[model samples]
Target: MRRKEKLVTVQLTGLTHKGESVGRTEEGVVVFVQGGVPGDKAIVSLARKRKGVWNGFVKEILTESQNRVIPVCQHFNYCGGCSWQNLSYPAQLALKEKVVIDSLTRIAKVSVNSLEPILACNQEYYYRNKLEFTFSNRRWLLPEELQNDVIDVNKNALGFHRPGTFDKIVDISQCHLQIDLSNQIRNSLKNYCLSNNLSFYDVKNHVGFLRNLIIKTNENEQALVLISFSEDNQSEIQSIFSFLKNNFPQICSAYYAINTKKNDSWFDLQCIKVYGEDYLLTNLHHAKYCIGPKSFFQTNRLQAEQLYALVKKYAEFQGHENVYDLYCGVGSIGIYLADQVKNVIGIEEIPEAIDDAKINAKLNNLTNCSFLTGDVKALLNDELKSKFGAPDVVIVDPPRVGIHPDVIAEIINFAPMKIIYVSCNPSTAARDFALFDEAYQIERLRPVDMFPMTNHIELVSILIRR
Candidate 1:
């Protein structure tokens, strides 16, 4: 237990919220292993310690976990995209569910009468609807590549960023998260850029033509590719767009954005439609949405359907109730539940998201749903309640920070009969649930697996007034 910066054998027993594997020393001191799984005995380097807890990473797996399996991807060892790909699918689900239960029991000090089983995703791989890849001049070479006798000088990469490095990117050839079409599109683009002598972005120097590429798809099998360029070369942009349009006729739309900013956050960046349609059609159950290039929809489409179904089930709507969807990005949940509820008034802070929400609502021909753009903390007030009658039910699918404290208080003041809470982070959810403990009682809770191959857990809880 006193070991630090030295090799020591440890047994990984659980998984942390940040996706690190949990292990312990012989003296019962906890050690977080980066690439370890439960039932695996491994040599760890306790490189850092904080708040009396040890943090380390696996040096070698002395004994493999029974649940561990061979990763499907060749770059799984170094790629930051997946954390639990080494563990079996069933084992991953079990660990996630355990994390939720542990968080709620310890942080919220609450338990449900009906702890419904965690919902498993039907499609484990290729379930994601969207993926954002970065372009870097300096690529992180794979272990096998480094072992080769002849060292390749090509360092340009167009894929995911390395886990711990900011400027290094893993040159992904075949990512298992999205459909094979995405792979084909990505590999083709990379090949075209490399052959045409296009410069990949240099994060440190802010030089290069290609910056990022986001490939998105809908359940309808339509595809959209949005490329970001650090330099606005009109001729090059036109040529690239034309190449994609001609080569990939299956793509419904293709857009490009010129982002010269130092940071690569392109959510607010304006994108120009260079080819095909303006938007792609994404359908969830009966709700159909017009997904723009920058719209913030759930990454996993099929699992989102399952997750929303759990939300509806927890809502237990009676066909005449008014609902409030706080933090309603793109208003997909509100639109999905519009038919069951008398009215759904959603409030969000992002203007573009609200715009997308309005368009989606119009596309669905839903008159019962309305979306407003503003701070949820400031907008969920009595004036709003007067304008739109008090929400009979509040369905909150908040960001990872969970709902704000003021918003939580306002929901308590409103005293809805039922609250359907959908959360992406379990630790924050447990803390916020504790805030509502006095006003409501937990009737049931179920964890939904919106993301696989990672340690993120989505939970849906049904709270009834005491």
Candidate 2:
């Protein structure tokens, strides 16, 4: 038996972190409604009812919100890549800033007078330096796009997956997030695969020529890595490699990864260099960095420079202060800041990333910086205090999950003079802010628009020991 649905008018309060509207019933039961912005009165249909939480849909927009904007992409509603497309760019920045502040206060237990002006990307579109597309047979079909042969897609360079459909993919010709070269490379590869009768990877059957496609670019240099699920034959592999090298001469590094596994693990796959070089090298500001097949580099290089500048400005180097960079990949930040400080120590979990970090340090001729490959928690335990002692300053550039609880405890125990927390996820950063509340005070919260045309934002916060 279906439960009776209840209709309610919600006075839209503000935007939630996920870009949904915050609303409540007369009984004060909180509700989150999609497609409704802040300050918009809407009639919503409650879909799910629980003890104190409710999920619903915006049945009617009773009042319009001034911050709403026309989404540029046609697949804005269905695609999983973008959430804030319907909101104005200025409004997006404002909401992002507010989210960061709220997270710090609510999660980190820290208060701030005001956040610094959000760092807006110079290029709102085509800013992503890298893109990864998944492979699947099931493709989504719109009402007008449905046909007899609409079930399985033969070949596709599907840009991204839909929100909840695990098997279905959204085939996109051009993604505004990446540069023009990515689209060109994608189109060229798709055409080549289709013409040669190459079979794309079938998620159900677990057999295919191509498993994943990754494209990265920095300045004028670009690198393309094709990850194949199974490459049992050498001749067929070399044939595709030769064709790519011959056609795309501009590709600085052309390589292939053979990942033969039921899962997405590519740890054992050999990186076969087919063309120009094994890696692509580029300069970020005054430092040089190298990128291999698996090494992680920031997607937005120009905006990254701006972010690094902010880090440098806040460091207030006395010319001999020692700095520790947690979660340092390729030692980019440590190497860049080597000259400004006495010595910089970097810690990362991945040994490959640590190897690249050391190589990059050597490439930049920065002998003062050293990278250690080990769990940050253990390093912070015995080595950090015994060998290096407490750092004069520390930089935490953690992933989306934010800093580990142990690391947070270590930082509080050590109590550095200045600490910089760089994060890709604002909510986690806000949570970590509360954890650091016992010791540090928030000095600045700056949000950088690394990924434009999407809801994702990069936030860098500077904290000082109380």
In terms of TM-score, the best-performing candidate is 1
User: Whole-model lDDT, candidate 2?
Assistant: 0.78
Which of the numbered candidates is closest to the native, going by highest lDDT? 1
What TM-score do all the candidates reach, one by one? 0.95, 0.87
- Please identify model 2 stretches exceeding 4 Å from their true place: 1-13, 20-64, 147-157, 265-268
Which tens-of-lDDT digit does each residue in 1-466 have in candidate 1? 5334587789888877777788888777799878788899999988778688888888889999999898888878578688888899999998888888888889999874457889998888999989999989989977567657447679999888887788889999999999888999999999999999999998998999899999998776679999999878999999988888888887999999989899999877899999888999988989998889999998988888888888898888999898999999999999998989899999999999999999999999999888999998999989999999988899888888888888899999998999988999988989999999999888889999988898788989988999
RMSD of each: 2.8, 3.6
Candidate 1 lDDT at 146 equals 68
Give the alpha carbon lDDT tens digit for every residue of 1-466 in model 2.
5567688888777776666678876667688876677777788888775566777877788887898777777766667576767677888788777777777677766666747778998877777778887655555676455645465545354557776566667777777777777877777776776778766667677787667777877687565555464656677677766776777766778777777777655556777776676677878799998888778888888888998988898777888888999999888888888889988999999999999999899998888887999989888876567787678889999989989899999988887899998899978988888788778878887888887656677887789999
